[model samples]
Target: MSSQSRKKWTGYAITSAIIISLMIITIGIYSFEEENLKNIITKNQVEIQEIITKSISKNISSELELITFELALLAESGQLQDDLGTKESNQLISQTFDRLNSISPTAQILALDKDFKVLSQASKIHNSFVGATVKGLPDLIDSEENKTKSESKILSINTSLFDEPEIAITFPIVNKETNISNGLLLVTLPSSEFFKRHGNIYDVESQFLMVMDENNVLLIHPNMENVGKNFFDDEIQHDISYNSALNEYITHVLEGNLSTVIVTLEDNIGERINSAIPVTVNGKNEFVFGVVTPTQSINQEIDEIIFLTKIQTVFLLMSTIAVLLVFMLKRSQSFKKEKLTVIGQLSSNIAHDIRNPLGTIKNAGVIIEKENNSQNKIISREINRINLSVRRISHQIEEVLNYVRTTPMILKQHSISQTIQEAVDTLDVPPDIKINIPNNDVSIRIDHEKMLIVFVNIVLNAIQSIGKNEGNVTISIRETFSNVTIEFENSGPNIPAKDLKHIFDTLFTTKLEGTGLGLSSCKNIIEQHKGTIHVVTNPVMFSIKLPNEHSNTE
Candidate 1:
């Protein structure tokens, strides 16, 4: 070989080496940035969740204070004066009960004799105890000194009911004029109302709040179906906290200190987060209000932010590596061809790697379709959906490789309606499922292949959700001068509100057989094409939106 040719070849080899080295470095940086972003987002989310939980606790405490004050004022009113006789005293008692009932939905006023037997009841009727003696009135009830001087003592007592776990505020009605006691005026409030009122003030979702009494009995449940059921009933196990945590909380609050505790409980379904707050009434600590929200709710938003941050970081690192590769290529003369060849090889490998899985999925579907039995029919349908997902994933990989292997290209214009139609056509949906698309064509600038993958994956998801039920899938497309918007909707059981934010996250699928990568990949592809995807789900409907911007034609 000539000296010049040899020199050129040597230069080319060095340049190729440098380009490959840059690519390797860029991939490493992408990985690092992804991890760092995840960490930061996770930390921030933890802090935010803590703030929200503490705010909820403080709000509950404030509301309890208000209730206590109202009860105190009602007890001090002069209507319980002894000189008023039975007629005036009864009127006073009736009027007081009416006011209490109006102010507190859960309030109950009880008039008890010196021995704590039932006398008159106000508010809701309680036939179980209308004439029954109070067998479990606490020692504080009988210890009032004014009972010796008259019939009752004006002593404030905080105790729980024997039949149920309710905290009552009992004060003796003593006439100031006679300086003598009459009967005990008991104002009973259920722990459920305490939590409910607090939840109302915060507008918290029902599932996110719960109240358990000191006995660990579920007095207040967001799901009204569980109300009045004991927390330790057959459905739930209470060993998580037992009674120690509740005791600690009550003791601290009774000493005028605020405390917070977190415990985990295993229910029929799964584990849940339980936050307990001790509520002190009238200088006595007898009840604890708890708020239990699922850990999934706290972690979901964080995961999304982390996922997006990781994607952005990966892109930035890739860009940096691309710049370095270009610099190496431009500096050498003979290495350009070799570098181009290497890029082509990498792109081919990525495509091949993606296509292999897709082929397997397709083969699985073909096999499933030949099966005859009903059970086999169900299995075949699921396998076919899996096949479609694999194909969708391969398409996404191809789009990414295409971008990596070439310079920027002009966006192609296509009919949005037609694109969605093609996507729906590709899905192996059940025979009972129906799809509706508008007749009018809406055009938008997008990478046709990439957009098709996004549309197909999303639509397939909707169809699968419809399953064997007689259900409908609706696709609506709208276009503006700069952007095109498409909405795919379906009828299905509502995705729990708590799980909505996590549906797109990696490894977060609700399906038993799902790998949890399809939606995450879809999100990556949509963002790569400078578009957005969102989901809205309710009991009767589930919808997805894809909005894309038109590239400038200039």
Candidate 2:
């Protein structure tokens, strides 16, 4: 082989070896990071589901509690007695019924005597009420709990007085002196009313919610026909033995503890994820709320995690390889060479711009010196301020031209206030733009010249962001026990969301004529001093935090 061919092959072999090593290292890293990513995604998805479940339970429980309270209050009013159905009794009952009628138009109220017979009612039975009866009225008496039963006061899924199913809330009117019951009052609103009220609480993913009463009978279902049926028997069914995994999961929940469960339908509707939580009605845990959704809801989170992991893995792998390849290809001509080339060009251009301003300053100075020689020299103060602004512009230009990845620093104890004033004295600010500086100053160990650059760049950016608008730029210092933060806030348009993250990135700028090195240089300077710089949008702000040793100089 020719000498050139041999050398080329040698280079190729070295590159292959390096690539193999990187691939092995990256595979190990990818395995670790992928697992971490899955855990994070799954944790976030469960948190969101828990929040939705809590909201559904709270909404349904609140509505039931309110209805029960209203029913108990009107029942204890001491007007409708057990023996008579008088005009005075009907009128008193109808007034309260009429008020609640606005919410449930078909709601009915009935007063039953001790014999469980309807004594008086403002229902649709009319005056033929001598011997009226209901289909499911006996269950509301709850005779098992003696005279102190509270299950009778809960919202029960019953359909006694109406043609269809209704939500019944019954309260007993007991004689307080005897500690015994006289009669009871029952009020039932339509099941559709409960469904209509709590169903639309969220237009989000918690759509498939099953509501059941204290007896485990389904109160509200998407299929209204399924209401008033046993939830464990009809809605949930395990294909195998009672000792199966799914059955065990269900038993765990029946044992009054929350557990995650997966159920597969025998009808091939596919697997579903279920989360069940108890609902509180009238200050008691008397109902069940279950959220059932398709398995794709969980798979979707997995898919997203996979997509994000792939993106991160590819980015890390490509960046590592690309840096190596670019270095090899440009060994004779490097990135630093190109950077210096740009810096040299900037220096020449900025130096030329500085000449005109220097000439103006020199002329102003000569006028003062010559006036002083006349022995009656009256030097204008305006000339001095203009000279100071011109000098500041020159100093900032040098900072931009000398910009590299890092700048050497000399740390000394100095007041942040002194550095800020010096930085602002260099800028030719517009009259319409107001600048406010804090009176309380804090000192820190920082490089004075480099720190001045950070402050100057921040203030100049704020002024430019305001443009011709009348805006205020406020600067303040907040000191903690170990660190002091200097903040710059401006009443300008908020930074766009898309560009906020890349604000300090090298060569990233929104301005048409910007070199994009001002903030980037500031970031480097702050970092070199072992400090951090951060920004927040919506009334743009920049905060620079530096280590402090309680250095306060009044």
Candidate 3:
């Protein structure tokens, strides 16, 4: 090859290699970031699971304690000490049980004889176990084989009768003077209560939860089919066998150590992520709660993020390439200079058009006010109204003029509190109306005069809405690193829903005498300052946001 051709070929090769290397580096960094993000998400899921577990357990335990306290009070009272056969005693017990059942939907309250024959039951009647002697009592009474004990002596027996997937807590009803145990008061709470209460507290969708006894008997599964089923049985044999995930979960729980694990299960729908936390109940490591969220849900979020990142990266790369090409071409650009000159001429024309008519109206109103005669009272009142209308029109015209006149300029920060006070001072608000300002000073970068117009417009609108009713207007200002937000909230009749969207449109008026320009003018001023303005019709809240900066001294 010729020397020139060889050099060209070499250059092309080098460029291609550089491009490939950069692509590989970018992909590697993205992969690493994605993996790190996944780990962080998993960690958060585990933490949330732990929180849900602890919260649910504490709530249930609190409910149980409250129930026990109430029962203890009833048992100690002289009312129930007379006899179980009496009409009055039966009525009291029935009323008390009904109240308990209403408050705790998952609990079944029972008054049983000393031999554990049920006198009454709170839940629906089932033929399998009602009126039968309690079968699970002996095994739970601190027996050597049971490997579990109760903290409160009153809760010595676990009569969670018939493998019905409920938490059975038995407290002995004692005679006060004799100090002798008479009958057992049993409360059976289903595990569904924990799931329902947890669901109400958090907004996450789809959770599968389970509670098991120390022997791994599945006492409660939020899924009704799993209730009255033992985890060690053939159908659920996989859950109880050693080395299995559920077995490991139970072991950690029974050891009194909290553990959170994420297990993936395949079902008819698809693979799902399950987060589990083990909780100790009544001194037995028998209950485990798990929340299942679909992997598809989290995967959807990841996919959206990836798509956005790719789009942003492509745009950024194109911008960088464009800048490089422009620099290489070495062209002198005067586009901004030409644009400014045209803008300046247009602004001068707009200002002249606005100011001339405004001045004419003001002068005409003033001349009318000066005229005095036998009809002076009527003339003066009409002149005053005309002057007010002229002022409103002039303010709106000035807002447009300012927008046309001001060039791209840096905003000077000023005291927002002072500006708002000045705006309020300009309004003819009724004395019955109350206005509240925040205690702290709010500072923001904005044109002081333009900002004044915004506040005045919002406040005037609020005062007009109040009319004759006792009203309150509250102003709150908050600042952050990037932006400052000011909110004006008022209590009055709510703005009509149909008019809400049109309120900010130019020349949209709700009142007969209004110039229909206040809100529109306010919107223009905010946009010119690179800020945003929004109105919330319900409760009549208006908010404005501006850039944050150090306050200007003057």
Candidate 4:
């Protein structure tokens, strides 16, 4: 491979490596930052949900306490101490329970006599608890009879028709004068109304509110189908392992702990961020309140951060590559300038030294030819040969100097036909060779002196390629809308395909006596005039295109 091609591939490899490294670094940074951002967002979300849950729990506890206080006051006023399960006593308790339900919508309220048999029960939905004895009372009844305080309790009932669980708050009905217990008031608040009313209090719609009893049973859920169900039930959770883990977490929350975790579910709700907080009444754990949110919602802010970071990384990568390209180009220009300066100095020194010796040799040959005696034609012919050799050497030296010359263009408008004629006049045409040119006069912009050198070199190259004194050299000038083209065709031997491609390359030649710089110098001069020059093989023709007057100015 050439040095130039090797350098090109090397540059590409380095650029590709740089791009890949930048991408890897950017991705690494994004991954690290994304993890930290998710943690921060999840932590902040948990804290915010905790605050909301605590507030709702506090409000509900206070409201239930107030109701119990009102019921205790009724007992103290002797309204609940009438004949046990009597018509008048049932009427009074029923009237008071109806008033309470109208205001707060209690699910069920039962007034039980001293034997724990229900006297009057007021329920929004169920109808069988009015006269039946309450079963869960003995487990929850206070052993200390003098205790005048109301207490809240949770219970799970086996109902054949209803799927709802119950949490009832009980207060003893006592006589104020005797300081004795008379009956008990049990109030069961509906989990649905309780959860629905307070769940929507916060403005966060992405999260769903849930309530669970102390037994890990779901008292309220966003999906009503799961209400009053245990967290470990297969109907509620299909994944056995996940259900076991979730039950463990629920038990932890019911034991009065607060936590957050990620869990998978089967209800089309994939991964979720679950925050469990416990609600308390009378300074004791009553139930657990949980806030469940989808994982995508929790990480939304982090996703946005990653997006912005990626955009910035892309911009930075492009900017860096552009800067590097500009820097490399500037370096290449500096190296080229240094190389050109050395070549110019060397060419000037070599041309100056060789020209003096060549001039002396040519002068000596010419003087010897003049002074030779008439009797010896041999000596005169030898002197003539010496002079010819000197001229060829001088021409080769001049070609070398011209090839190394780096003259800037000094453009002016010149007549194209006139310039061609001038260049043809400078060439030594044999009497046997035919020369042809068009008479049309067209003008174009060019550096006259340089373009003349180009025309002289190309015409001479075509003539020499014929290798005979009897061939034709035809010159034609044609004009186009934007350019003027000059073509030179000679009846010369066809150039080999392999040699034709490199004909205009510096230091390239096919002839034994050729200096090799004539055509290359012609190419350089034509290019300096903001034009192009090329050759064809069949007729050994050269074509030159020069910009017209209007094109040059534009």
Report backbone clashes per prediction. Answer: 2, 0, 1, 0
Candidate 4 Cα outliers beyond 4 Å, as residue runs: 1-21, 83-103, 121-162, 177-180, 203-207, 221-226, 230-248, 264-267, 299-313, 317-554
Model 3 steric clash pairs: 165-219
TM-scores, one per candidate: 0.42, 0.47, 0.49, 0.46
Evaluated with lDDT, which candidate comes out highest? 4
lDDT of 2 by residue, 443-507 (tens): 77888978888898899999989999999999999988878899999999999999999999987
- Lowest lDDT 10-residue stretch of candidate 1: 149-158
lDDT of each residue in 1-554, candidate 1, tens digit only: 99999999999999888877765766676566445544444444333333434444544443344444444444456654433225565566567666655444444666666667766666564443446567657475555433343222222223344233454656665656665556566666655554555454333455666555444455656555665565555544243346565456545643544445444454442434444455443334434555555555544644554344444433445555544443343334225433433433444445444444455566557766656444776786687677667765665564444333222324677777888889888766777888898777776667776677677767777776777899988877776666666777788777887889898775577877555656766776677666677787764333333444434653
Per-residue lDDT value at 74 in model 2: 62
**Over the stretch 1-554, how does candidate 3's per-residue lDDT look in tens digits?**
99999999999999888777766665665566556655655555555555555555544444455455556645655656655435665567667677666445534566666677776555543333447777656456444344322222223223334435456666666777886766766666655554455444343332355656555666555455666566667766653233377567656666666666554444432444444555443444445555555556656665566545644553336434433443333222224323333333333344344444565677677766666543678887887787888776665555443433323344676899999999998877888899897777876667886788789878888988988888999999998777788999999778888888898886688887675667887888799887899888768899988877632232
Candidate order (lDDT): 4, 2, 3, 1
Given candidate 2, what's the lDDT at residue 186? Answer: 76
Clashing residue pairs in candidate 1 are 12-335, 218-231
Q: What are the Cα lDDT values of the candidates?
A: 0.56, 0.65, 0.61, 0.69
The candidate with the higher TM-score, 2 or 3, is 3
TM-score of 3: 0.49
Best by TM-score: 3
